[model samples]
Target: MSQSLDIAVIGATGTVGETLVQILEERDFPVANLHLLASSESAGQSVPFRGKNVRVREVDEFDFAKVQLAFFAAGPAVTLSFAPRATAAGCAVIDLSGALPVPQVVPEANPGILSGLGKPVQVGSPSASATALAVALAPLKGLLEIRQVSLTACLAMSSQGREAVSELARQTAELLNMRPLEPRVFDRQVAFNLLAQVGKPDAQGHVPLEKRLVNELRELLEAPLLKISVTCVQAPVFFGDSYSVSLQAAADVDLQAVNEALEAAAGIELVDADDYPTAVGDAVGQDVVYVGRVRHGVDDPAQLNLWLTTDNVRKGAALNAVQLAELLIKDPL
Candidate 1:
């Protein structure tokens, strides 16, 4: 922990990348030199670090050998293209984008996975929804024999990036002023309407996000054969992703134990039944997942239902990757 290491943040100009920089400063990661990298278009932009605005350089031109650790917080294309070069240069990589088929890690759920990784370590952070779900459910895993999980993830526009967030705002303003609305970032009007699917469905009628949830959640929970049914709905919100989850347990449900488990778990804030949580009210700009509305299904003691929310950009993507780095540096990176 005393040794300082050079680190690089890919896609530093983007939302998740910027948040990663902020969290690294906030958590005081043992960093030596901090390199901020972006695409050609985003290069020359500056991201505020500890006490200075660090000018971001183009990722393609930067040498990966300069840093001991690198965080790939950009899109899949960026991670897919540059991560191998980083690993080839002996730099440890923690990717937030789903490009790499490496291990999907949530520190709270599977911190032990890092120790078993191979040399020139490579790991992936789960999607925002899966990260929140793993934080909520991992604690209860030992107490309940979960058979399957059903979830409807209400994603905010920010999950799609800054443009989606702006489009939501513009569409809302035009609607309020009774002006003609033209959808640009989204295929249709997302303001005051729920999008049934996030992207085009494959032959099996499941979108990519849904597949990501299933695969990543299973990995995080260490349940390779676990059954999961998820529907990623685009909610007309600006930030935070919410989930309506139902877990089918093998035995009769225990409400008190479930509540206590959530209450004592790390990276989770359990709300009382008196009032439920909303994305804007509870989760936005926060670091932990907010869980409420915990109860058993009507006339079905084996079914447990809950509501969860978290900041998709911060806690879900950036912070999760940063946390993996913290654990990875525990020994040597």
Candidate 2:
């Protein structure tokens, strides 16, 4: 049997944080004690875990030295403020907020990066879109050297957090009732409409989400020279993320071999050509990336296309954080 350790989950009331707590129990991670910490506004709330209620304590009041591992699912500001403190207190941290200036880890793609780390170091989890993209491209890395990658990611409002989810629900209802649309969580209407940009545009015109996907993919693939371009769109749905990827390989590739490679890849479920996965219909609550609609360019056999989807909250954020923690525990690096 695995030995139990003390664990603390920051931002216990947020969407990803809540999911992390649930996954810890679902995956049967050995735990001697579980601590839930949140901001003062959310503190005192009870979160269910292992058939009991665990009250959340204010993060400012919690002592990081008490826990062996800390999972930060809070936003960037919160993570930045507390992660360093936790690390200094000798607590290993797996940050899902993408704010930590640490090694960004996707366990399935680069578990080795964590093996050499010192104890109590902070590890950043890649963005949801980046995580899905990295997992999809991992199998194709050596099979056919990729020259460039272009992708369009359709993200749901849930990726923004629980408030965004609630805003989407509110806007959707108002629209159905023929009321004026109120856009708060998002810059524009997200009810039965799609936003071309997911975040504020940069000087070069690329949104923050798009920039993150490109940068993180290159990092996770360990291919600094690899060229990647991405467009992030906010879909009207409430959960899951979908991607349409176009890969330009350096050499001719066989369709059969590509399909076989994806089939054998970890944390991926390749669907049949005749069937495809939708975020709402197939990806929600699932733990693996669902891939289908694979086809090679007719004019250029070196080019390939694919459609991928996964639960943004599950495999994208919460599960990946938990898996990273598991890896750190097993290796204690």
Candidate 3:
């Protein structure tokens, strides 16, 4: 807060990394200098920061001196290796990767959770589950206590990381070109197909990542007793994470008020026309979470159904990380 900030974007060539740069530019965040970091393969590549070209340096060569903040858009492996060094060198790290296991944060739901860090060495939720959960609960928090929530996520390829995004594009191209497919990033071909699993299978055959999503949302919402069930499926879309939520509230809630609440929610847009359910393509490059389809169970007034969408790489990953950083900068601990 005393001087212009020196910021480094680790993994500057990935999907979230590119969006992090764009968000910083679009929001005009104050920065004294910018550094782009990636693996050795992209060491000499250059990415535009503000108006100048910042060459992508290898993570091993990142100089943390004078850097006020470092956005870790890489992965857990990189964060485990570099984040501590950056913090030790006096740089605050805002990681987009799901490296920070504790203190899970969804800005709208848990802004106060990141309090008292003069230099927050790490921040960010791994996937869109927390982001989508926050948007869906915004209306219910005021109307009725969210006793329980059941959600199933249609995760986009981009959420898996840059490699998966590339796989989606490459596989799609091969399909269009009528070429034989050999999947690399994903366990199977993503084009013209869906994977009912994400991350890896656990004892019950449910993906661990999806279970973590439910756990992360519970922690962020501070509803320890909140009943949450999730089934994550990998969709072919390149961006956007969608969730179908069925919630049971404390009492009979007003549907109109819920709709209006969603409409007025900060950092969220309600798409409520007859044909206005937000689409995956619609969320690409957008910042806000989109919510729609409000319905009440006929026999149970406390039960509700809704759909939510968000740009996984933006709102779900980069933009949300930036939003947390902005909040920290405004009311520094």
Best by TM-score: 1
Better of 2 and 3 by lDDT: 2
Q: Give every collision pair in model 2.
A: none
Give the per-residue lDDT digits (tens) of candidate 2, residues 1-333. Answer: 347889999999998999999999999998889999998999999999999999999999889989888999888898999988999899989988878878888988887899767777778899999898888888888798999998989998888888888998999889999999868978788888888887779899998788877888899999987888888988888999999999999888788998999999999999999999999899999899999999988798999999999999999999998888787777553
Give lDDT per model, in order: 0.94, 0.89, 0.79
* Candidate 3, 35-58: lDDT as tens digits: 889989878988887788878889
- lDDT for model 1: 0.94
RMSD after CA superposition, every candidate? 0.8, 1.3, 2.2
For every model shown, what is its TM-score relative to the native structure?
0.99, 0.97, 0.92
Q: Could you give candidate 1's per-residue lDDT for residues 237-274 as a string of tens digits?
A: 99999999999999998999999999999999999899
lDDT at residue 202 of model 1 (Cα atoms): 100
Clashes of each: 0, 0, 0
